[model samples]
Target: MKGISYARYGGPEVLEYGELPDPKVGPDAVLVKVRAAAVNPVDWKCREGHLDGILDAVFPVVPGWDVSGVVVQPGVSVTEFTAGDEVIGYVREDFLSRGTFAEYVAAPVRTLARKPRNLSFEEAAGLPLVGLTAYQVLVKALQVKRGETVLVHAAAGGVGSVAVQLARHFGARVIGTASEGNHDFVRGLGCEPVEYGDGLAERVRGLAPEGVDAVFDTVGGEALKISADLLAPEGRLASIADGDVVGYGGRYYWVRPDAEDLLRLTELAEEGVVSVHLSQTFPLERAADAHRLNQEGRTRGKIVVTVEWEVEPAG
Candidate 1:
């Protein structure tokens, strides 16, 4: 099957497109034919060895985690889905080898969910990781309540955008940090948008005077450093970007794949409670370019890489 892989950890130059062997399915897994895959910053981070201490990489690694595809076959022990079932998955494991960037992936049942019928494969491809991150952090880590004020950093971004919408769905008033240009875009997602950088805390304070009830930090470093100041007493804080958040009385979160949580996202999507915005799309072979654009750090939403299948001639 044709796909992308890298034999060594380096820059995007290391990614190559070619034929790789098909994956072997386990009893608790299903084989999904590639339709589309979403590119997350973590994809490039893993490619460059930034995640090496946590996830061991098998060289010539196929690198992608989020996929929207169809089941060609189910594993011997599986009954949750069968051939022709449309599904999406955060197809990650403890290490990197087989991944969703390929023509097919063997996804464990624990990572699979039925795709939202209201979403296209490209949009559905962008959901699993970002949706899971937002849902997990908002519902579990921060416990944001209705009528509370919440602030989200990088509000127009993949995880941030979803977080803003999900928080609004829970009846919280949201404030999101973006740029002057994205303020309109962020507002469209149902939040008051504040430009990030110098005076970020002041801008957030302007919106909520007493301080927000929760701060969702997607931009770390200096942003995480000041997040504590933006919070009201007993206000919650969580950061997916910085581990130092733990030092500031916040939870440093890493998103985990859960079928139940993903299903909730699917339901929200179907009900029009949340949406995945596709900022760009690239053919599978040009995945390296996708990484380059995402690394530029100005994307408003998710970037996706698509696998186009040839149409069979009718006889």
Candidate 2:
């Protein structure tokens, strides 16, 4: 099999595409033939060793988490899915080694879910990590309620875009922070768009003078601090970007893969309540380029890397 990997931590330059050994499936995992993999900021972060404090990297690590693919074989003990099932997964474990940026991956059942029937493989591939991040944060961390005012930072981003949409679905009046260029895009997601940077607080106050009922921060540091200040009395705040949020009386969330949660996201997707905007896509061999594009930090939606295989003609 072939995949993208980096033998040591560095920039995108460290990533190399080449032949790799086939993966062995575990008792609770299934071997999937990769269709598409989503490019995320974390992919590069892991490549550069930024997550070293937590996740240990096995040398020559394959770097991807979100994936949509078909099951080619199920483990001996697995019954939840069989060969030919289409699935999506956030395939991260405690360590960096096996990943979705390959021709195949052995995904644990806990991290797998049936792909949304309404989405293409490219779009479904972008959902797991970003979708779960927004879903878990809004539904569990902040508990966004209808009729409440919610503020989301980086609203046009992968996580923020889904966050704003989910908040609105829960009946919250959402205000999303994005660049001036993305205001219209943010507005289309059922959010009141506010330009970030320079008087961001004032702009938010202009929309909700008293303060918002919930703040979802996707950018860390100053953005997280501003979100902490924009909350209404007894308002909730959560940040996926900053661990320091704990110091400001907010929860710092790390997205976990749950089969149940991913299923709900698929339902929302099939029901037309949630969707991925595919900003760009690259072939698996060009995954390094995908990382470069995401590192630019201006992407409006998800970037995907696709694996294409030739099919033999029918007998």
Candidate 3:
């Protein structure tokens, strides 16, 4: 099998692409022949040792969590899916040795969900992490309701883009912050677009004279601070990027692998209620280049790395 791996903590330069042994399927796992994998900031962050204290990293680590693929083998205990089932997974294991940026991944059954029929492999690949992040923040963490006004930081981004649409589906009025250039794109996703940076708080005030009902902060740091300040008296706040949010009466969340939550996202995609926006894609060999693009931090939507393989017909 071909995949990307790094022997040590570093930047994209540490990534090497070549043949490696295929992953092993466990009693509760399914081996997926990856059709596509999505790159998130955490991929590089983990590679550079930023997540070392939190996640156990086995050097020569394959790095990625989001995958849309076909199940080629199922574990003895797995009955939720079978060989040839098309699935999507946020395949985060307890350790970082084996990952989705490969031709195959042994994904635990708890992390696998049927891929949305309306999405191509490339699109489905982008949804697991970001879609789950958005869904968790809005529906689980914030509990946003109909008729509420919510503010989403970095609204045109991977998680934020999906969050914007989900907020609308929940019947919340959304105000999303993006650059002036992506304002229209944000608007098309059902958000009242507001330009990010310096005067963000004042601009948000202009949109909602009263504070917003909730704030979903994807871009952290000062944006998290701003989100804390802009919330209504009873407003909820959650940040996926900033742990500092805990100091501001807000919760910090890390996306967890849950097949049921992912299935909800699949339902939303099937209903045309939310869509994964693919901004760029690379062949599996150019994963280092994919990391470079994601590190630039200017992408409007998800960046995916695609794999091509022959799927044996279902018997």
Candidate 4:
């Protein structure tokens, strides 16, 4: 099957597109025919060996974690889904290889969820990793509650956009930081938009006056440190990108695949409580371009790679 891969850890220039061996399905996995895949910053980070200490790399690695596709074959032990089911997944494995960038992937049932009926394959493909990242940080790590005031860094970004919506859904008054160009876009997600960089703290203070109850940092580094300083006396903080949060009495979180969390996001999508804003779509062969675009750090929402395939009706 045709797919994109890199034999060694490096930049987007190292990616190669061609035929590769099909992934084998394990007894606990289902083989999916890829319809669409979404690019996350982690895809490039992994490609460049940034996660070398945390995730084992198998050379000629297929790089991607988000996918929306049709189930073509279910393993003997799989019962949650059958052939012909349309699903979305954050298909990360214990090791790096056999990823969603390919024409097919053997996804464990734990990572699979029924696609939201309201979303197309492209939109559904964009949800898993980003949606789950925001959901986990807001719902699990920070435990944001009703009527509280929350601040989200990089609010117009893939994760931050979803974070803004989720915080609003939880009844929190949300303040999101983005560039002036995306202020309206952030407001559309139900957040009070503030421009990021220098004096970010002062701007947030002007919006909240009393300090925010919780802070969710997606940009890390300076943003994370600034978020820590904007917190109220008992404020909580969590960051997906910065480990520095731990030193500042905040928690650092890494997104994990939870079928239940994915289901919650699916419900939000179906109910029109959350929406994906796609910045670009590329063919599978042009994955390098997708990576380049994401690395620029200017895209809002998601970048999807669509796969062309004939869908046969299940008899």
1-315, model 2: which lDDT tens digit per residue?
999999999999999999988999999999999999999999999999999999999988999999999999999899999999999999999999999999999999999999999999999999999999999999999988879999999999999999988988999999999999998998999989988789999999999999999999899999988888888999999998899999999999999999999999999999999989999999999999999999999999999999999996999
119 Cα displacement, candidate 4 (Å): 0.3
Candidate 1 — which pairs collide? Answer: none
Q: Model 4 over residues 1-315: C-alpha lDDT tens digits?
A: 999999998889999999999988999999999999999999999999999999999888999999999999999999999999999999998788888998999999999999999999999999999999999999889999999999998899999999999999999999998999999999888999998778888999999888999999888888888888889999999988889899999999999999999998999999998899999999999999999999999999999998998756999
Identify the runs in model 4 with alpha carbons over 4 angstroms from their true place: 311-315
Q: Candidate 3: give the clashing pairs.
A: none
Better of 2 and 3 by TM-score: 2
Q: Write the per-residue lDDT of candidate 3 for residues 152-258, one digit (tens) a residue.
A: 98899999999999999999999999999999999999999998778989999999989999999888899888888899899999999889999999999998998
lDDT for 173 in candidate 1 is 100
TM-score of each model, paired residue for residue:
0.99, 0.99, 0.98, 0.98
Better of 1 and 3 by lDDT: 1
Candidate 3 residue spans exceeding 4 A from truth: 310-315
TM-score of 1: 0.99
When summed lDDT is taken over every stretch of 10 residues in candidate 3, the lowest stretch is: 303-312
**In angstroms, how far off is 193's CA in candidate 3?**
0.8
Q: What overall lDDT, based on C-alpha atoms, would model 3 receive against the true structure?
A: 0.93
lDDT per prediction? Answer: 0.94, 0.95, 0.93, 0.93
In model 1, how large is the Cα lDDT of residue 41? Answer: 95
